[model samples]
Target: MHAIHIERHGGPEVMTWSERPDPTPAPGQALVRLGAAGVNFMDVGARSVGAPGWSAPTGLGVEGMGYVTALGDDVEDLSVGDRVAWFYHPGSYAEILAIPATALVRVPDDVPDETAAAIMMQGLTANHFTTETYAVGPGDTAVVHAAAGGVGLLLTQMIKARGGRVIGLVSRAEKAATAEEAGADHVLVSSGAGFEQRVKELTSGEGAHVVYDGGGTATFRSSQLSLRRHGVHAYYGPFMGVPSLPVTDLPNSILLTYPTVQDHVPDREALVTRTAEVFRMVQEGRVVPRIGGRYALSDAARAHRDLESRRTTGKLLLLP
Candidate 1:
């Protein structure tokens, strides 16, 4: 089978479509034939500078949906031909994968292959941000930075599904309609700082109840300024820039947290539960994922380049 491989960390040019041996499922594992793979900024980070678990001479994907062609020992719960999807399995860019059974979730019949693949990683992250990081209640206002992006769009819909209002922030004027179409109550076309006053004005002098900040250092302070007293600042934008904050400098008695999607599904049971909820939301037509672009699996390098440029909106998928 062919897969995307990298020998050294650098630009998207480092990615190569290479041939590899077919993998056989081991105990408690299932062999999946790729349907589609989701692209994320983290994949770019892995290819460029490298992350803790990702290094050179490795495959470059973590989220995808496929069919179970076979299952290994003790994997009695799943059968051949069952459609399944996973959010985090390293080396998912391959044509086929032998993923642990515990990490695989059955895809609903109503959900299309590409949509199922698209929602797993970003959907779960938005679920965690809305539920645990800060419970979004009715009538509450939220400032979602990069509101037209993958996680941002999901966050906006989920917040609205819970009866909250979204104050979306987009860097370019052209992206405003995209954010509004995803249920953003108000969209601000401003980059870096200075968006705080607009957020306050939209809220009628009372700031937002929470800020889902993914804009990094450039808008970190603006996100904080847009929040009300005791509001929650959920920072999950490590791909842009990391900001340093002091407790003494924390304004408005607000709380700050860096939430990870993994924590929302720490075990198999949690994974199943959270995934079911996301799928349910999709079934209800309340959370529809917008596909920004699609690329052939062999052309994943082009997908990476588009994501790094930050010009694309919604989710990008790789089809095999």
Candidate 2:
């Protein structure tokens, strides 16, 4: 088997499609042949510098969907040939992987393989933002940063599915229609910090009920300013830049939180439940991922280059 591995962290150039010994299923593990792998900003971060649990000499992917070819001891629930998807199993960039059975969820027949892979990470993060982070209700307004990107598009749709209005923030005007197509009621094309006024204006000067901010430091304060009094500011963006804030700087009596997707699915039970909801939403057509690009598994470095350029919108996929 071959997988993308990095011996030292640097840029996309650091990733190499190298040969490796085929892995056998270990106890409580299931061997999966890769169907499709989702490319996320988190993957970029992992490739650029090592994140926790992602040290050098490590394979470079976390979310993907595949078929179970074999099962290890005590893995009674899953059978060979079953379609499965996982959101957080490390080293998912390979043509095959030995993932713990507990981390894998059966993919519904209604969901396509690539679609299932695309939605797992970004979809669940969107679910966490809309539900637990702020519990978006009918008529509530939300400001979603990077609205044309993967998480942004899904978050916009989920917010709309719950009957809430979305004021999408995009870095480019050309991406506005994409965000609008995903149910953003309003789209603001702003580079950095000046989007709060438009958000306020759209919300009738009352400000938004919540701001789902994945737009790092430059836009952090703007996201907060776009919220109403007592509104929730969910800052999930850490890649662009991480900003330091003093407690006294918080405005509008709003609540600030960094909602991680891991908390949304702390265990196998939560994983099953959350993924089921995301799959049902896809089957119902409430959430449709725009597959912006697909690259061969060996050519993943180019995919990373395209993503880092910020020219592509929506989800990118890797085919093995």
Candidate 3:
């Protein structure tokens, strides 16, 4: 089989195609013939920082969907030929993978292969962020950063579905429309200043009840100011670099949290519950992921290039 093997940490070019031996499923594992792979910033960050998990001479992906060709002993969760999707199975840049049975989730027949792969990570992240983290509800005013990006789009809709109003902040005019379409009550473009003021104006001076700042460092400060006193500040991504604000800066009863899926879903049982809800939302049309771009497995480098270039929106997938 051929896989996207990374020989070093650096640019996308480091991810090169190579031939490798076919892997057989081990006990409690399943050998999946990948149909598509989801490309995310996680993969890019791993590549950039030389994350020990993806050190040299390693394959580059963590999420994908495919058909199981074989199942190892003790794997009663699924069977051969069952269509499934998974997250957290490293080396997903290959045509096939030997993934833990626990990571597998049944892909509903109604969902397309690309959609299943594209939505798993971002969808689940958005699910827990809005549903469990701050518990957004009616009359809540929320602010979403990078509003048209993968998680942003889903998060915006989920917040609205729960009856919360969203003020989407984007870097470009085009993304503003996408976020609004996803149910953001208002869209604001950052001009390197005054985001908090804009939110206050939109909410008629009440400010937002919660601010989802995935834009990382660049938007971190403005995100706090955008929130009303005693509001929730959910800091999730580090796209612009990891930045932290002193607790003293948040006046009143403002709440700040840094939630991670690893901490939220400590085991397979938790993952199953989260995935189930995200899948239901997609099947019910409450959440729709935009398939921003598709790339051939051989072009994994180009995929990484486009993703880091920030020239695309929604989810990007690699066809295996």
Candidate 2 lDDT tens digits, 105-124: 99998899999999999999
TM-score of 1: 0.98
Candidate closer to the true structure by TM-score (higher is better), 1 or 3: 1
Error of 2 at 135 (Å): 0.5
What TM-score against the true fold does each predicted structure earn?
0.98, 0.99, 0.95
RMSD of 3: 1.6
Where model 3 places Cα greater than 4 Å from the true spot, the runs are 191-193
Give the residue spans of candidate 1 off by over 4 A: none
TM-score of 3: 0.95
Please identify model 2 stretches exceeding 4 Å from their true place.
Answer: none
Give Cα-based local distance difference scores for all models: 0.94, 0.93, 0.85
Query: How would you order the candidates by lDDT, starting with the best?
Result: 1, 2, 3
Give the lowest summed-lDDT range of ten residues in model 2. 233-242
Q: Record all residue pairs in model 1 with backbone atoms less than 3 Å apart, i.e. clashing.
A: none
